[model samples]
Target: MQPYSHARLRHSWLPLRPCPRLLPKESSNTSDAFDTLIESFAFPEKFDFVDIDLGRIRRAARAPQARQLTLHLAIRDAPAESPAAQALSDLDAASFKLFCTPVVNLFQRDATSIQLTSTDRAYPVTPEPLETGTPLDVYSIDAVRLGDRTQSEHEKGASSSTAAPRTAVLPYRALSHGRQPDPTVAYWTAFRDPYAAAGNARAPILLSLIGLDGGSAQVRHPQIDVDVTATNGDLPSRLPIGAPDSDLVHEGAALACPIRLLTQPTLPCSHARGHGALWRVVAGLSLHPFDLTQTGLKAFKDFLRLHAPRTNIVAQRSIDAIVGLDHQPAMKWMSLDGQFPSFVRGIEIVVSLEESALRDVTLHLFARTLDRFFAPYAPTNSYVQLIIRSSQAGQELHRCPARSGTRPVI
Candidate 1:
């Protein structure tokens, strides 16, 4: 007792009340009542909703060694003398099945099917001491890789130089195999921090319950309640280095910013919508670091002054022209000896609509157009943007960026 100087733990006991028995309707027969009773008894209230603790999610996002996150299945203890409690007494944890489908970026192509597992076991493990609620059943998820383990220094450098920070939503749902009804599911979204230092303190990966899908009649579709604050909370008030009005000496900005084009048009004659389709188009030129040298820079300026304006190319035509520019010997060698060849990049053209829905053929035509547009530039690592916009206010709803290497199915 003297050796154990810390305070002792205390326990309290509470009295139990009688649990109500299952009562069948007066009009029901004995067989129907028995079946109802059996169904109710078999599926007890012990298995509740599943959740991942915030701390676990934070660790998964920031920890250098964390490869996956753990999900906990809440299990409650039923009254000792109840029939439901007795039914679960000898339950085989392996019989309960749960599956997770990661719905990423609202694009079906990136979705992944992952089967959840318990601690060194499959899902739905029984907690110790069936009569009293204590430990929770655990499931591990390895959907997205985190930290330096998954990326090399060169890969990280390349990604930071060429790409923006990517974000995605991961919605989860349980699959029913006819033995039991599906359980309600929920999920959160996560994005990698592009500016964070490697293997040092950075922003914690935040995960909040963004949506929930249940079997209730009132809830027709999955309701989404995202917390956007988590992602934008720590953003600096000042603009970034290459911002439009900034005076920073960024070489990439000087080369790319001057040639940008932005236009908005309402196309009332489009086949996709009889009323009108609103479009926002933005096009720009990009030069690699090697093109920033004095001689390479001169050639770029010469091409812009002499060749670019003569082409009479708008954003749409420029995108097509850039794809076929390889065939033009004069343009391809604008830079002496082709030491620093220039190609078009950063093209964004979006067509929005306010309508019931586009016909199947209309969507098919768009897909085919994308396929043809990117075909010639496939080897050059070009990509096309396909956006789905909201009908109410012509706002962007979701964007699907299809790379030239892979064709997208509408």
Candidate 2:
């Protein structure tokens, strides 16, 4: 056995900031006010860099009666020579159109009372080709304004003496190139009512940018040998890779390779509204290396009947008549009520491969059963211990622990 090779590539979220010229001058009062405003918006740290426009804050601080102000935002860290920067430059040269929309959250005001609107303007902006990046001068925010309730009542044919606070529209601006904008970038308008006294207003806005394609990115690594053993002393064999999306490779033994495992970050669609928006973006990776032949399937059924005798008769009949193994590989054993049966508690898995091959094997033992006997338990620590042994001499080769929510290569 020899030492293994490893490589890692990481992509960071683009930093967000106010337009350079509009940044407020250095002052404690202005900076404090600006920081408070930036915190209220609650932009996702992984997607956009959120901060307050100091120039707007300074102007507001100096003139308390000023009714309106606009804060412009742009990407802060894209180098001119980067791949994403080049992609944006190409998009700009081609005059591609980008669309903008507003996502708002009101904390203290009624939803119907305040009207938050954004211009339907489309701008010519695009994300970097291989990574995530937003260009400068892409989005703007408008200041909050207060309207007279009495003027509203007169228009509605009602008489009222009190002049209560009426409709308030948050300020936001959109910049466009001459050509029509693409529907990629969607802006969200977030602001606290400037009319309200300082420290009393709070609002959070979320901005989502789409249209970045990750299908071009594919990861290829050395192949690793895998064997599936069942309780009846029967081993599942590898089938020919016929499916278009199959990741199995054959080199004397069945090898599993992850080709489309890594992907670029993508924002969820607009329908996933409200506080839970971030959780909707999920990435999953799974690989099934071997399949059960007709003989192996019968052996698995017999093993199931002998072990789980109390299993429902209907479930047993369904298992006996199971088909489709010829075309699709089986990944899980039997799952009853979304849980592995008690009989599948202490199954052992032996990996007998060289260190070079071990580097490519990411054993993801999920909560479901595997190979009709092995069901990795989901303990409190969220880790499953895996022991690798040498097949020739039956000696301990390695000890690896698989952790949940992360990829651990064995």
Candidate 3:
């Protein structure tokens, strides 16, 4: 129902660039070469600002007059501050030098209210006693989180493991609009899995930093604190919240995309700009490896089909079976001759007539032929191939094979 601004900083400080080779003949793959060039030009994490010079590009235009250009800017966390904290801050444009670590488990002990206390004497501190050992100096909010019920057939089938609960993180950031930034973070909120979907899904957590951004730094405000009281009603549905490393083997795999570096021109407002950049980094890394593996599997399947026909049929059946198609007729055709391959699992036969004869005589002979000539060797995987040369001709030469595997005696 509501659009959420992401709090995380995506790695977009990298942008795509063109390859040096002008012709396809000069490079292995132009697209890949271009991707490399993009990576080469990727910006370091430290620079988050970009300036637009419209005057420089408008040389041909009569209005070469200089105009102030509006640029969309992204700011990285200050070196003294951690990116994780920037994600959690409430100020629109506050700068912190401390590194913020991501908190995976936000559900600790529930607090009835939160108190903000300054770590430094220069900053105002709330007098409220925090949960024991809750970091001193930082505004501490004691809040309560509760879970509600889930109803569904799937929930009914869920086992105890499915109902298991875990801690969720609530991420927040501060932004400045027009007034002085609030010194204390506020409006803390988080999302959790409803009891039914508890173990199976991830939970979203969102917290609002009350009024930390606006205006100039000269307008100092008192340190604000929140007293989060618990409620008996249902936990709310909406809260927004927001990788591991693999040692690469030979540059590993990469997804083709443009990347841009982010810079934090202003401290408190960095998240408002940096979130999109952080998302790009994460998306590229996640899909690259999966794409590589899928390509390999498809090529292997194609190779099998080119080398062996028998194996190809068997493998095709196996693949079809995986998609839930079974009991279809097998594709093996055989003539009256006994020649057949070992791979075939079944056979069929068709009988035909040769020359003209009396109707009753033909009927009787056909029955006798099947009983006396062919029925005896039914256990063997062999069958008669009856060929009818001409219907109007008189009785033609009749031939039958013997049980010793010799040519049919005429």
Candidate 4:
């Protein structure tokens, strides 16, 4: 994918993000050592960054690890490609935030320096943290504009160094949601049937539930504190009891739906804005008969070891898709430059998976990070009243929990 880099920053032109990864070309000699930098930067007129006002961002660069990554996002998980172009072509500006995270062992192979080159030729650029005497370990710059290095005496300041720019950090915007539902009782209809493929072997358990006809007043966004209990027949199930990958899901199975109530904020786009961030996830596994939860997680935990990118694990095969829901909104581990515990010391979580029966599979289920980032949008409390007549194109089976204890999932 062509790297797109555009910013209204007066000092720099980089918007750090998690993706646009780079893969090195393989060579015949496996023993050969190499150091490389893969970067993508473009100044497409199609992207209007003026709304973020990144022009004032300054004075926030420190190397906690050999690898330092900074992210500037106006929107969450916006796909990058022609489709994204079409989906978001209408917007002018959008909400924005800045984050800096240090990755451990990004340069374990060899010391390498990364340089970001933006296709935007008209706008010249320069490196920040203008101090020249500091140490810059192996660095993998995410989103940045490569600026002109030309120096003029007129631009020189005290100590023959460029003046440090002021740093600006934005607070998260909170959504207004009531702690309790306006009404505890509500009806829900099938939003869509899972794709036939997911319904079979790939991942068949995904069932959607949007507000039933005229139920918007009761079912709303930021519906936090989701807890619904139900019998096996109450929830949705396309795969038979012995569904494919029985090791992961099976019969006599009781499923607990840990549904994370998500909020899709109306991102501030230019008057005629485009699509909002998309959240898609499938992460449910059946447990051993009579077990009630994802017991397979114990066996799968063998593959749960988290390590650096350029390192090796004990496994002989590459089984990375073990996580789901875009790895729960693309969750990554953080190190805080090695300050906090591993539980909280991975990558900065922009989005995260909610705690559910499937929690063991991915790191995105970190409730702490998830709440902090989306706190503003979370409802004080949330409850769903359901009456499931039938599901997965199946016959009318049962209703929501009558008394209590059965968990309901959406």
Kindly give the stretch of ten consecutive residues in candidate 4 with the minimal lDDT sum: 32-41
Write model 2 residue lDDT over 126-232, tens digit each, in one string: 11121122111112232223344334435346545544433332112333222654333222233222243236222222222222231111112111111111010
How high is the CA lDDT of each candidate model? Answer: 0.28, 0.28, 0.27, 0.23
Off by over 4 Å in 2: 1-125, 128-344, 355-385, 401-410
Better of 2 and 4 by TM-score: 2
Report each candidate's C-alpha RMSD, comma-separated, in the order given. Answer: 34.1, 29.3, 34.0, 29.6
lDDT of 3 by residue, 325-366 (tens): 011112234433556444332312222232222211222223
Q: What is the TM-score of each candidate against the true structure?
A: 0.16, 0.16, 0.14, 0.16
Off by over 4 Å in 1: 1-58, 61-97, 100-343, 346-381, 405-410
Model 2 accuracy (lDDT, Cα): 0.28
Rank ordering of all candidates by TM-score, starting from the highest: 2, 1, 4, 3
In candidate 4, what are the lDDT values of residues 1-410, reduced to their tens digit?
A: 22234544443222122222232323343211111111111111111112333223322232333243344546443335322334556644353322421111122121111222232111111122212332222122122111223222222443535633221111111121235433433322212222543332221122122222333222222111111111122112222243333313222358742322112111111111123211100011111111112343333322222111222221111223222111111122333233442322111112111222221221211121112222112122211112211112223212221111112222
Minimum summed lDDT over a 10-residue window in model 3 is located at 264-273
lDDT of 1 by residue, 1-410 (tens): 01222222222111001122222222333223222222222222211213334454444355545545443334453345433455556667664434411110111011112223222111121212222332221112223211222223334467577543322334333222235433433343343333542463332332223234422211122222222211111122122333355423335464743321121111111012112221100011211311322344333233322222222223123222211111111112122223364553422334343322321112222222323232222233343444434344555534444433222223
Against the correct fold, how does model 3 do in TM-score? 0.14
